[model samples]
Target: MELVVYLAGQIHDDWREQLKQLAEQKGLPLVFKGPQEDHDRSDEIGEAIKGTQPSSIYRDHTASEFNNLRTRIWMNKADVVIAQFGEKYRQWNSAMDASIALATGKPLILIRPESLVHPLKELAQRAQCVVETPEQALEALAYVFE
Candidate 1:
């Protein structure tokens, strides 16, 4: 099944790589959003995704570009959004993520570590599901896609 995963850019780069790998392994199409990168990593990640699954949307567009306006456009097309919730960082696109997901009423899978503190618990409760691990996120995505 196809899944659109919206990750916060402020998280570690390795986490993005891991989620991408997991998606590829599951034969699930992934849509990634976050930090800017050079040509090589971009090509590699794209190739990895293409190798195993149906074509997916990779939004290189900045969350700021959406700024509630653009996201409303794309959110309608996305089936699911996997986001890092309750994180505060200068680069974090929490507002864009929450607004778009909430607006679309798409199934939102929010991922947060057990140790992390979050103010979005109620929001997550309102979401399709709240996950504590990548595995949980994947499971939630599966449910959403189903």
Candidate 2:
């Protein structure tokens, strides 16, 4: 079966590459998408909201609304949502994406670094499974596929 893997975390290039590798090694027909991968207009929303002044409240609101819509769309299409959360990589957008996944009844897998205390531990607990290592993450994905 074709699966869409949505990896939500800090929008860093290296993180996306790593997740892509993990998805590849799974040997499944998986399409990986994330905030950093920006298949939609997420980047445009980021640019529109960047450094917004108090006078630009309307623009900020519009950008936020647009981003929410895009995130919901992505979440709806995902077979599973894997959120990477840690003290250093915690992001509001990632939390929002996780929330969307929950609301849509999508399987949510939360991954946190083994060494660090997860900043969003409570949030992560809501996932279908909380895992530390990449292997654990893959195992969680396999469970979902089962």
TM match of model 1 to true structure: 0.60
| Candidate 2: tens digits of C-alpha lDDT, residues 1-146 | 88888877666446657656776777757787765355345535644556453555655676667666666677778988987765565467777778888888888887777654446667667888887754577676666567
**Candidate 2: where are CA atoms >4 Å away?**
36-43, 46-56, 114-119, 143-146
lDDT of 1 at 23: 74
Q: For residues 4-108, could you state the per-residue lDDT of candidate 1 as single tens digits?
A: 555643453466678778877887667765433343444344445444333334333322233444345556666667676434454356545755677777677
Count the clashes in each prediction: 0, 0
Candidate 1, which segments miss by more than 4 Å at Cα? 9-11, 31-73, 86-92, 143-146
**lDDT of candidate 1 at residue 42, scale 0 to 100:** 46
Query: Judged by lDDT, which candidate is best?
Result: 2
In model 2, what is the error at residue 32, expressed in angstroms? 1.4
